[model samples]
Target: MKVRDSFSLNPVGNTSKYTDFINYIDTSSVNAGLLSEVSFLEDEFPSRAQRLVRPGDILYSSVRPNLRHYYLYNDSYEHAVASTGFVLLRNNSSYNTRFAFYYLSTNEVVKYLSNIAELSQSTFPSFSSKDIGKIDLPDIDRKAQDQIVSILSAYDNLIEVNNKRIKVLEQMAENLYKEWFVRFRFPGHEKADFENGIPKGWAYRRADEVIDFNPTLKTGNQTEFTIIPMEALSTNSMVLDSGCFVRQDSISGRRSQNGDTLLAKITPCLENGKTGFVMGMPENEVLGGSTEFVVMRSKALTPHYVYCIARSYYFRQTAILSMNGADGRQRVDEDKLKSTKILQPEKTVLDHFETIVTPIFDGVYQMVQENKNLIQQRDLLLPRLMSGKLEV
Candidate 1:
């Protein structure tokens, strides 16, 4: 059976089910199976928010299929809408929906669709829902489909659990930062001296004075270095995805090392919170990344402090406001970003904060590495099972 016969494409138009507000999902907010939350009032929805997603549907990006911007819509939001950039699929046949999701999400399927998109006339790689609908589906029994889902979901469930733990660890660190810095309730707060409404020895200064933005690095005589693409940075997480090694003479971009924070300066990416805390790299090894990244290193504070500040809402909003250029291509002005005011806590306090949060960040990194392994294991099994090379 073909996908068109197995599922309904872009099923919408139930005006009666419409509500006052909606949870909107765009292609950029999804990667792999993870999704970032975005909401809007019904009247304020974006032009592309045309697909009304159901509970058991799959949302697949039509543009740049190679990026694997897809999600299984099981969110509890009552009035959820997705951008038209996605090809919504609602299963209506006997085939298991989860199985179909995994099948369509295989690297093989993505590469095939990507090839078709690249060969098209569109300026950007893109394809139509019709292209997805014509792909053949395996004629497997429901039991076999359920077995495949069972095996695959085991890996997914473990990954989901680790993700939750990583999120909690991040929150613990961020909350600690808020308690000590934002609320001015650090250790010995009751006895702390105050100057200019801030704890004594703590003063506000330009970000550039305390944090170095796009700090210079010497990469002379290096033959190869690790390269991180913009997509490797997660909008919802501080951990960076593993990047591959490339020759130093080939691609040109920013240079960074361990303990540096890479923040995306581009429009939607900056707004989407695409920031990464550089870690787990080899000692004394410098890395290369997209020029769109602003490499931040500590000049007067701890690396942990710089990372927490970059993750803070105040810093992010300031960066957002500093963006300049064309609508879709706007970038944060490094000068403006450098000029933003930031608090400089006492040296002892900064040291204490780092000592407390280092293990938390380390734990998060370990979990991220584990998830990478799990994903690799699952990906290795996916194509084999889908192609019937490996039996359930």
Candidate 2:
């Protein structure tokens, strides 16, 4: 059967009530089923934010379908609208909505739509709802669809659980940093000498004095190295992707290693918290990343400590304030970022803090690796299950 036979394409959801604010989801706010942003806007909403989304609706970006910028909207937002760039699919058939979502997300179907989008007359690669409506999908019974969804949903559930654990672990480390460094409540605080608002041995120093900003690294005669693009960095997490490798002769970006912290210097990205702690790479792998990253390596402080500071609100706000250029293209100035002042904790306190948080950071990375494996297993089974080659 065709998609249009089973789903109501871009059905207008009820937006009957008046509200002072809206939760807006832009096309760029979603990626591969991950809903990264839901802007709570009280003033002037974007002109494109016109498509209202109801619970259980599928939001698929009309532009660049291959990037898989899609989401299954399941939140309880009373007044939420999506950018007009999406084709909202609401199931009206006997088939399960989740089953239809999985079918649409398969690589084969995505590539098929992407080809049509590329050949279209639009200014950019994009397709209309008619393109989606014309595609063929199996007319499976509700029981069969439920079985397929059950198998796929198991993997997704595990991923969600791990994500929650990762968030908790990150919060633990951040809280520790604040308690020890920011609040000056480290071990034996009562006995510590205070002078001029700081402990006797501690002093506020320029960031560059303690951390190496965009420090040079030597990639010894390697023919190729891993390349991590800006999108691979998570705005809310410290774990980074195991980037794909590219030949050394072709191109290169900012050089970093497993222990470095990558801070996005660009406007919206930096403002959105695109900072990552590089980890889970092979031993001594010299990694290359987006030119927009300010690669930070610790010189006088622990690596974990520096990473926490990079994630800190104070440090990010400082970097955001130092940004220059036009509105969308603004970037943090390296010189100004390096000159920003940060508290320099005493050596004993720094070492003790690291000792406490090292396991927390390690645990986060372990869960990240686990999630990668889960995704790979799910992708391998997706096509087989969708095609009925592997019986449910």
The lDDT values for all models are 0.87, 0.86
> Which ranges of candidate 2 are over 4 A from the true structure?
13-19, 241-251
In model 2, pairs of residues that clash are none
Model 2: lDDT equals 0.86
Any runs in candidate 1 off by more than 4 Å, and if so which?
14-19, 40-43, 243-251
- Global Cα RMSD, each model: 2.2, 2.1
Superposition TM-score, candidate 2 onto the true structure: 0.93
What would you estimate as the lDDT of candidate 1? 0.87
> Residue 389 of model 1: what lDDT?
97
Q: Write down the TM-score of every candidate.
A: 0.93, 0.93
RMSD of 1: 2.2
Model 1 lDDT-worst window of ten: 243-252
lDDT of 2 by residue, 283-390 (tens): 777888799989999999989999999999899999999999997999999999999998888898899999999999999989988888998898899889888899
